[model samples]
Target: MTKADFVRRCRWLIACAVLFASANAWADEKSELKEKALKLNSITGKDPIDGKIKELAKDAENTKKMLKVAAEVAKEKPQPFQYNGAFILARAARELKENEIALEFFNISTQLAMKVKSASKLLESFDGKISLLYEQKKFDEAEKACQELLDLEIDPKFEEAKIIVLEQMIQFKAKQGKIEEALKLTDNLMKLDEGGWYFVRLKGWVLHEAGKYKESAETYLDTIKKLSENKRLKEEEKERWIERTRYILSSVYVDMGQIDQAAEQLQMLLKKKPDHPTYNNDLGYIWADRNMNLDESEKLIRKALEEDRKQRKKEGVEKDKDNAAYLDSLGWVLFKKKQYAEAKKYLLDAVKDEDGQHIEILDHLADVHMALGEKKEAIAVWKKALDTEPASKRDLKRLEEVQKKLKAAEGK
Candidate 1:
């Protein structure tokens, strides 16, 4: 063959070989991508064929790079792609704690998701914003965002979100110490869903703090009953509700001077949580004050003190002041047993170390000092007690009587 003809034939063969290799490589890549797309689709529960098509389309940059290399020797083609890439990117940004990036992406996602009519995606974007505001402690901003969501009529479908928003409002009001506003919010919350036991419990706490003890007790009982009726409540939750209700009932009964009822409720509570320090101390102190169950009271009080010490040690907490009620109970019990000197030490310590300037602690201290013949100290403490603002007419009368005795003793 001629030299030019041989060179031309050789060039044609090289070009054909290059084109054949490029086509085979493209086919192999396409098959591998299809397999990957199918696996992702199956796992994600999306349409396999559509997923494959979208994957090919969205990876245009990578595909373009491949196609450019192939185009040097053969024709290149593009694949179709359609997926919420912006939404996915936004979610990734949020997960990484890149709030600025997340905000940008979320805005884009919201716009795109709205066009797609994806309610769930739109809700997610709003929730992300709400959560960010809340995490920043921007309560007013968070509330505004929550209100916006509510205005969108999302609450009817997102009942959990609605409940959360209501709870947040209640918490915000409570934290501000706006008890009346909190109660009003609680009432509105209850009207929205009367069967929600959490709202009932919140209402009870509000009433308790407002000194409506009887109403608080009734609400607590209702909360307990409602929680018990909820099949979705875990066993632990039900037990907690019962324990809380019983504890509140006991406290209210004690406040109302219904000692027998208080004792009954406390007994039930103690049975469930035998070593509960506060309950043990309160029940023991109550019994001692009533001059009933002295032996049991002493035992319970000692146990409570031990538990308190253990808990304080664990939590690295220090109570610089004495527990006035605990000391008063111990002192009164010692006086009942005629251990006058020992009673005087505890009562004096209680009066000296008590916070809140408790009148009852001072009264006990004065009475103990009188019994111990420390007449001057007794008179001083009695006068101090009389100076305190009495909560009731009975307390005022008692104060007056104590003062009269102190004056008579001083005169003598």
Candidate 2:
């Protein structure tokens, strides 16, 4: 061979040797990572919370390594371990806010769990996948996942999970403007539940969400009537059901612009359980929102805050922070009463609380800022309200209103 040909042959051999060495190094690393993952025993056990997975998720480098090994194991391992690896990867991905990866692995976990015929693992995987899909507003995929969950070979012990899935499916359909389909799902749920009153109440909720206020109110009344006649339910349970339905009926009345009817339902509930925080807050907020009974609304709101604090103490919550919703009620009532300064104070605190970090509450705060002539603050708050994730159809509507408000304020 010529000298140049000999040199070319040697270079080709050297290139092949380097590639082979690099492949070996990757194999070694993959083996080490797989071993480390399998050693996270808690992930594959009855308790799936693994300190190692959580610890690994806390660091970017470790998270990358964990995901790499987990993907390989999920793809190549056998049934149970495959599910375990996928589940671990999903959990870690969720922790790191890698939602798309989490959704993918959760789906893989669900498929593997089905192969292993593990009901609990399947449910967990489905839950993770469905919630991620829902949060991402991938409604079509969420609808499909919900149906798949209902089609699972659900264990008797997991019947409640099935019911919960049905409820989510109904809500999904309702939000998509598929009112008839949503009602049909509710009917199916009622059949599965043997015509339980709660299902009837759920039907009422579906109707209410679909803007069928009259039908919704009637269904709620039907639910209450059924509750009263059910000999199987204890008196206290029946009463509780009736009270909740009444509260729900009140909202239906409010939607129909039947303020008097709404107030009557709440009044009935308050007569029986005077200190019920929710009842007080709802009635007070409704009256305040309508700019009627401002004095009485403020009183009821204050009572709600007080009663809510007492209830939290009774429940042994370590922190005794005031309920954010109740605080919003108070702030809104004060705003209606033209006490903008005090209203802003309560609203600022309300917005700081986790539960109060809602578009509606933010709008209320923004309104207060506008009332107090803080135009810049109001615009900022309205922008923030728009930025907050809308959790429901109502929030979406509120966001539209906020957009309008921002446009008007900016124009001014």
Candidate 3:
């Protein structure tokens, strides 16, 4: 061989040897990283793994460093290591609340997870995506993700996750004011567990909101009966269910204008827990508004206020800044007793604190003002109240009376 050709061959040999050594070193480094990750996974509860994950996520400089390392490693190995690295990065991103980065990582994880047939990992990724979409109020995307989960054919072991997604879909439909769609979805949930109290309660709430009070009351009654028979539940839980059922039934009766029936239900509730302020307030306010049993209404309302104060003091809880309903009840009761000054004070307090412009409170305040001969203020409050009154015959009649009073006050 010629000297020139031999020299060229020697150089080529050296280059190839250097390349092989570098590749071997890179492989060793990657193997070491994998071992370290396994060690991390082996650590027990209260370890620094979660902290390490969080720290890595917040270190944007380190994330770029790791991503570059991942790209290089992926170029060299191009298999399982790439998937593992991507998943680790995704977890870190999620911990940092960098959802866009997390989503990108999740998409890569989904592809890798599917390739490995890692059902749990895939489900986790899908769940993260669905939750992100839901938080963003992207209901269409959230629904799509939910559908993807259902399509995955995940085992019954993940039943709770599946049910959560189903419930989310139902809630989304309900929020969109699609009551019929929500009801249909609820029926599907019921079919999943024929006698599920949770589903029954959900159906009752939806029906009540949709103005199907009779059906709602029946559903609530059935739920109460079923829950009562379930000896497996604790006493506290059973009591909660009973209270919920009675509360719904009472509300339905009130809506139907069956005040006597509502009063009866409230009486039963009070018998169970005589200090239930809501029940006391509602029942007393109903009677006071109708100008019936003025003395008893006053007693009940005062009892409610006393109960609330006692409970707050016992629990070391802060009192609400605005007790508008309680004040309104007190004011109306005092008005019935012809104590105009005392009634005006409480009603005005309610009107001032109720920043949401509560029509009922405004009406009561106007009535008190009229009694106190504050003609201008009474006319203003009455006009404001009338503006918000529902378009019903009874409300229209009240509006007419207010207008007549306003005209008389104006000397028209």
Task: Compare the candidates by TM-score and give the number of the best one.
Answer: 2
TM-score of 1: 0.50
lDDT of each candidate versus the true structure: 0.67, 0.84, 0.73
Candidate 3, pairs of clashing residues? none
Q: What shift in Å separates residue 113 of candidate 2 from its native position after superposition?
A: 3.0
Task: Name the lDDT of candidate 3.
Answer: 0.73
Would you list the clashing residue pairs of candidate 1? none
The candidate with the higher lDDT, 1 or 2, is 2
Tens-digit per-residue lDDT, 1-412, candidate 1: 9999999999999999999999999888766644443233132333543454345445656534433332232211331212243334334444444455545545555555455655676666666665655555555666655565555543345655566666666655553456788899899878877677878888987776566778887887888788889888799978887887778778777766789889888888888889888788888888877888888888888787777777777887544444666777778777766788998887777766635356767877787888888888888888888787764434666777777787787895
Q: Write the per-residue lDDT of candidate 2 for residues 102-128, one digit (tens) a residue.
A: 877888888877777777888888888
Which scores greater on TM-score, model 1 or model 2? Answer: 2
Q: Runs in model 3 with CA error above 4 Å? A: 1-165, 168-172, 318-322, 354-356, 383-412
Model 2: how far residue 276 lies from native, Å: 3.6
Clashes of 3: 0
Ranking by lDDT: 2, 3, 1
